[model samples]
Target: MKFSLYVVAVPLALLGTVVPASASFAAGPAGADGGAGGTAPPVLRLTDGPADKAAVAVTRPSPDGSVATVPVGDARLTARGPSGGLVLAPARSPAGNGPGDLAQVHAGDVVAGPTTQDTPHGVLVKVAAVHANGDGSIAVDTVPATLADALGDAEVDATVPLTPGDLKAKPLTSGGKVTAGAGPQGRGVRLNVDVPVPDGVEPTEGHASALSASLDLSPEFLFSYERAHWYGVQPSRARIGMAADYQYGVKVHAKSSASYATGHKPLRIPAAEVNVDKTVWLGPVPIVLSLKVDYFYDVSADGTIAVDAEEHTDGRLEIGARYDAGEGWSALSGPEPVSTATPALITGSATAKGGVGSHAQVGLYGSVGVAADAEPYLKATATAQNTPQGASASWGLYAGLKVNGSFFARLDIFGTRVLDKDWELPPLRYEHKLAGSDV
Candidate 1:
């Protein structure tokens, strides 16, 4: 079944309140007017502590008449902008995550704090601040939740604000919910599991199924004729192969397409590898378990780690499982020391990548391996006109990018690398061939 694997972005609004200066303090009756039997008013006194801060200008007089005049002091204060006259106040100091570091905490709409609040849907995270001590140690503190929810989950994780090398954090929650169990080493289960389904189908309590299939064709036309030696040695040969495979399964299946080269020229044809898996439900509702297994030709020690996105009929997204084994690493190509006892390397990926509205696909299937200390070869002759008789073994990876239905192209870069010994092959030992279009 297809599923969404990308992060969803949403819009946010700003909300805040400010108090006006006139409402800050109210002065008592200027005359202290006691209605009946008025006594003498208490003498008013003024005290000046320091200069008024340079930035703080008294825009309006205090109603309580208790304003103390002070010279400009350096104390910071919040002020509203001139246009709208919005009031600003001193914001509370943010708490620290650990020693000398700031902590991230929030104080609103919390779902999984003091109570196991069941939220409609949201992301949750664990946070801590760690300070690295000089003695190769660290100090950690839990992140405060005072920060806005949006900032907390996305930016900061469950990490402490300790020294750079002093802190470690474990994932605590995601999707607006606290993760089950404890730290990273703790064993816990996902709150929900994904089940595969076909396009345009919504998942229900019962079992869901999905299927995918593709057709491929490759043709190699070659013409060759050899000279007849008068010494009674006439060499002529030709060969061609084309095969196709098909499969259907719950999660994945296996299928392939292959073609051989005509004559002695090596046939660089395509191959097939398919897989499907599904989740089986006991009753009509809620899936209990899921099983997924794929088929692909592994030609190298490092498996395929390639990823590409595709949209399924059911409005879900799928990604191709391809691998990039760093430099000097090739997928669908086995290791250099190819031998019977040596390990077998395999690489392949499956996904209808790129393009839109289906019909377009980018799949992977091929073999890449190594034979140590051995020059593996098969000999043959060429017949007819223009055919060449030569033995060739290609070792490299192929990447295909297709668009629409009929417009497709792929580039295969093949070369041999000796893994067992570097200087084994002489400079002239290597061979190069460009077989496809524009080559």
Candidate 2:
């Protein structure tokens, strides 16, 4: 399939204007001026009250296509309307007021939600709906507003299709018979092959058979997200996270059959193989990453008979990022193992009882600040006397991450393996086998 990867980075400085650390709610528009033809809006005054053990408010959409405010505890006031359509201003406590003063919400004001400290002495106001009077007075509406109301919602999903321009394929052997065709369902490219075999093929020592194909893929972009947050006195933190997943390698699909005359020698055939090398950019970032993929499939048979073997294998790499505020940069996460390789299947029957076997393997290697390696492999064998005998195979996929330079946070998911003086994660493995079968 065709797809593009996009990397996004957001800085905290552009989030929004900072407010007073002491005041949870920021100041609203100035009060209106009282003039000849101007009327003043109703005033909603709030006063500090005795601390209540339970005080909470929730803002949600109402069935009537309006927003609704629900409050619980000491004072319960419900308002309905669109959220954040109102405004709120800080309340001033009267002279000689103490910490235990009783909290009061006037007719024009409503408690949007509970405060972080859960104290009425310094009530936090989340204005839902309030009108601005010409005289600068804050007027209350039927709807309440809170921080949740002001933010709305944030969520997304995206996808990109694959095309032929994204893939390049070639034959491995000179003069090897190879043809490119449509992939399954017309989504990807499929390579077909038919190589020439030499006459008077010797026994197990030698026979003539050569056919293989390889492919290189354009860089693929995946997904990304950026966010900036400003905490009162704390340093503003700019966070950006992104991920990419792509596949490359040889022998993605191999199916073969061969026949030989009577002989005691067995023949081994390198059915298919490929190698790839490419450099890629980490979307929108200046960092450079390189990757390599290699694949090989082989089949062998001893005796005068016919043999059939087939193998389907693929490889994928997943890349992720983490921001290092201390270093003012982002580091990549270690690669993880994925189960996408199919088991190798080999079936054969010989006139003279002999043995047949096959092996397939794919290795994925990558380099960023550090080096990483992962391999998925399979093997199978079977024997036939005078009757027909078939054999199925099983395989395993594993990865190893080695640090060559500076140290970064370790991704615990990948097991650990120590090589030289560097620490590496043990490769992940996926296995599947047919019953009563040996590799």
Candidate 3:
């Protein structure tokens, strides 16, 4: 069946909401100038360049109202101006590929062109004004819809006025609508139009669509792993804040949240501390560093963190640094002590007591591992070094609790460990008490 289609720009009303409509490229007699018969072919002229000033004398005109030959020069033109600028958009190529010579120019876009340029090939008019829709999008109106509808056949020609009698129609055969399962390509089945083709006519237009379903997922486990391993995920922070340390480790942001740090023991409870260490390679070898922070319910959770807008929650602020050795000490030595394998980080560190500290016994840290019973958690063991004579080294135990939090943990307290010994070793500080160098 010859189902002809036409392409026309739909006027968008700035006084109301707008809905995007799809249009087909108007088709017509085989090999016609406009694809649509009895219409002048579209002309291409640079609206912003010297070529726009070139005039065409219509050297030759074809029977189809197409220019067989035309003049091409910058001097053979007249300089005319439109009231406002033009919005020029990149035109898609004929093959639907990419940018082409053709441009989509809206009436009121302030196009980049000097007012002194003009062409005598076609008629041009001055646009009264231009306006914005407030958004980054532009809205241009060439002719009022009311006036154009009233002018009818005079405003535009190819679109013939359809009389009431043109509404008569009869079913040629029958078409079927899909009432059941999805089609082969994961979409709803399509309905087939069974109308027969006319004797010398060909179908010039058609549309096919099928329903589709899509699923998006965010797995907790995967996000957890990615956050733990990837440092410097956001480079902008490093470029702005820590340009020097930026080379050592990319700046990383760490946040933990909960509806409420509640119950006898909520895993991420108020000021409950957790230590997670990973081994990364800046070059060929590995640099093992640990992130230990005791969080306080700090900033109110931003709505971006969750799907439900009304479910406002709270989050913890992290006060920690990406690590490099204090001053001495080998780069890595892994998560555990290389010489002792004691599962402790005996490294020089900088404490916020405001300066650098040497040989700080930070604490015992852990990696993500499941217990023998498949209980997923990080295993921890707190240890102390009592280097003074006759003192005893004490140790404690803790696990990086994920769901079940530290019940009694405070700002400085970690997990559920009770401070039994005075292991208050000063980030475990000591200045090598250098045997006899005047204490």
Q: What is the lDDT of residue 348 in candidate 1?
A: 35
Worst 10 residues of 2 by lDDT: 279-288
- Top candidate on TM-score is 2
Per-candidate clashes come to 97, 28, 7
Best-to-worst order by lDDT is 2, 1, 3
2 or 3, greater by lDDT: 2
Off by over 4 Å in 2: 1-163, 166-219, 223-308, 313-376, 381-425, 435-439
Q: Per-residue CA lDDT of candidate 1, range 172-245, in tens?
A: 32211112221112211111112222223222223231112111111011111111111111111111111111
TM-score of each model, paired residue for residue? 0.16, 0.28, 0.12
| Candidate 3 similarity to native, TM-score | 0.12
Highest lDDT model number: 2
Q: Ten-residue segment with the worst summed lDDT in candidate 1?
A: 281-290
lDDT of each: 0.17, 0.26, 0.17
